[model samples]
Target chain A: MPKVLMKGNEAIGEAAIRAGCLNYFAYPITPQSEVAEYLVRRMPEVGGVFLQGESEVAVGYMLFGAAGAGARVFTTSSSPGISLMSEAISYIAGAQCPAVFVNIVRGGPGLGGILPSQGDYFQATKGIGHGDCRMLVMAPASVQEAVEMVMKAFPLAEKYRNPVMVLGDGLIGQMMEPVEFPDHLKSEPTNKDAWSTNGMDHRNSKKRNIVKSLFLDPALLNDNNLQLKAKYDQMRSDEVMFEAYNTDSEYKGLVVSFGTMSRVCRTAIDLMKADGIEIAMIRPKTLFPFPEKAVADASKKPTCTHIISVEMNMGQMVEDVDLSVKGHLPVSWYGKCGGEIPTPEEIIDVVKSRIA
Target chain B: MQSEVMFAGFGGQGILVMGKILAHAAMEEKYEVAWVPSYGPEMRGGTAYCTVVIADHPIGSPIIKNPKHLVAMNGPSLEKFAPTVKKGGVIFINRSLISFGANRDDVDELAVKIMEIAKDLGSVKAANIVALSAFVARSGIVSMEALKHCIKEEFSNKPKLIPLNMEAVVAGEKAGKK
Candidate 1:
């Protein structure tokens, strides 16, 4: 496909249609409302279902219902809206249903601001829902990457029978860039007949497929949790995706960042390279599978001294970095919680002062 | 290899659209581009601005503090962003609305009466197109042919507005040469 200038949110909406995900349910919120706005207009043209739920909570259950029936379904919401959808997300995960959620994150524990932020890092990767639920979280630094990740998410969700999240900041949702939606990435729902609650007649006379998260007996609940844990373990084993930048040769500092913040760090790395300062960076494309081994291996560089986690939030991802570094290198966190993104100069200064 | 332009004006003045047109033109020239807008609540009824980053390489940080050029549609926009333009870069001032100078001697400042030019051309709504053409023509960031194609494509839906906008581009490019 030819490249077109598109906002990240609108590109995401178009990407789902290209990916053959015909079910979309969403609630309007700042920064991300454009995703719903775009899909509401485009879905009908493609003979797809576009329903704007009353709230994010309703949207979450709507995704669960559509996805349970083996339909490719997704929704888009911001931080606070995601919070309302958390319960249903947990239920969807518990039932092992396939769904996609795009969180174009805004600021705060409450409705702190409508600008971009990575404060929802923990919310997306760790606490998307209650219980032993985990979503395969993908963080995209650019609009093009968001389109690719959104297209890749449906197949990944079906592969694990789990929810997959394309986590982006408000900037990723609001900014416009040239993006090409590859024709090859179109995907159809696969292998859903065995477990989906699609009508038995549709599946060629199979036993009833009950899609529910509730396991009344304690042993069954434990078994279900163990089954979910196994899927997550498999994700860690086979689904880890990451990108390493400027890691060749020896470097004094290693920076671990994801999402929009990674692009800023990338610029800082380029500026520092020009100044005869060597710094390597690892940007996690999949925040869930987390790319722990890549961070661990990159930290083991002989010339590396310390690591810094630069994010838009206070210190959420730093804890994970510290764990990934395994205390071999001291991991420090620097960030701004407000809507203001950390500048490239700020990142360079922090790495120079803190790494040494 | 990389340059940024800031388009600043009040909310209904097509500030974002101006940046988008520049970005589209740059993209047509096979350069990577990103268009970032000030999406704060202030866009409701306050100063609206957008930054267009055009680079030969993939853009890293979309947020730009100091842009390479400026298209100030009003006095407040010029007062706010004119100082942020890099030295030796083109700064397009819509002199029809902004009365003051850019106060910088280091840059090539092109002051055009964009509003009056557009008004005389048939509609003041084409003022953004006038300013965009002036900025593109003076800065040489993208070729005039590429920009004209983008302008034609932008108004492909309403073919009626294409001729007036094409005239505005001609006038702005003429003004930019001065």
Candidate 2:
């Protein structure tokens, strides 16, 4: 398909349809409500189902129910909406169901504002809901990338039988850009009949598929936790993705950033290059199963002196950057979390200060 | 290598649509483009604005603090955004709605009475097209041919309105050259 100019939110809905995902359950939220708006009309045309629950909490369980029945299901929400859905996220993860969640993050501890933010870094990567729940998180910097990530998320979710997250900021939801839907469609159902509760007659086996998160026995629960932990470990080795910019030259510092913040830093790096002062940036495409080795290796180079994590939130990703660097370099954070994005000039100034 | 245009006006004034048209033009020309709107808390008569960035390479940042151009369709828009426009860029002001200048000498100001011009052509709704076409003619960021084509394609569904919009585009282009 030729590239057509489209808003990020609307394109995401189309991408899901193209990816053969027919079930979309979500509640309306700023910066991302367009997804629901687009899908409500779109789903019917494609013979798919689009449902808006009374609230996000109800919507989350709707996802659990659909995903348990082995239908490609997903939801889109903002910060607080995602918070409301966290319990269902944990339950879905524990039940080992494949589902996709797109969080177009807005600023918040509470109903803060409807603006682009990376505040949910910790929530998405560390603690989404509770108890050994770690979603395989992919962060896209552009609308095209957002579409691509959402398409790739479903297969990855099924690969490990876990929830995969496509984490974007408000800008990725609100902005318009040129996007082309991928030609290939994997409408073929995955090999999930053995686990999915689609009834005994549907699958080859006589054993009924029981989809539940509750493993009441201590040993059984331990086994389930270990199984989830093993999937995470495998992701660490297999699915780490990142982009390294201007890393070839002897740059003074390494910038660790993701999503829209990284795009701003990319501009800053280009400007700094023209000034004869080179700076490198490592943008992690996958937040979890993070590009730890890439960051550590890029920063450990003899020429790279200081490393800084630039973000829209108050130093959330910096912690992960620090953990990745492992004290090899003096790690610091520069941010403006009050819904105001740091410009290229501001990022350039911060990098200068870090090097100085 | 890159140019950023800011379109600001009242909410009902089609500011976002103006920016989208410019973005589509740029994309048709094969330049990477991004259109970001002010999706903040604003009402119908309240403030509305959008920024369009066109770059030869991939657009690095969509959050443009200082735009290369400003097309202000109202008084408050010019006053709020005029100061932030970079020097040596075009600033289009709707003189019919705004009386004051941009208060700067470094930028090029094309103060046109878009509403009056659109009204003279036929309807007042074409004010945004007048302003947009005029600004594109002045800036030359995208070719005039490309801009016109995109405008036609944008109004493709409304076959009846295409001719009027095209007329508005030509009128604005003529006004922009002056």
**Highest-lDDT candidate:** 2
Residues A84-121, candidate 1: write the lDDT tens digits: 99999999999999999999999998988999999999
Candidate 1 wrong stretches, greater than 4 Å: A184-188
For candidate 2 chain A, which ten residues in a row score worst on lDDT?
A: A183-192
Model 2 regions more than 4 Å off? none
Lowest lDDT sum, 10 consecutive residues, model 2 chain B, at B36-45
Q: For each candidate, what TM-score against the reference?
A: 0.98, 0.98
Give the number of the best model, judged by DockQ: 2
Docking outcome class, model 2: high
Residue-level lDDT tens digits of model 1 in B69-98 = 888888898988888889998888888888
Q: Clash pairs of candidate 2? A: none
**TM (chain A), candidate 2:** 0.98
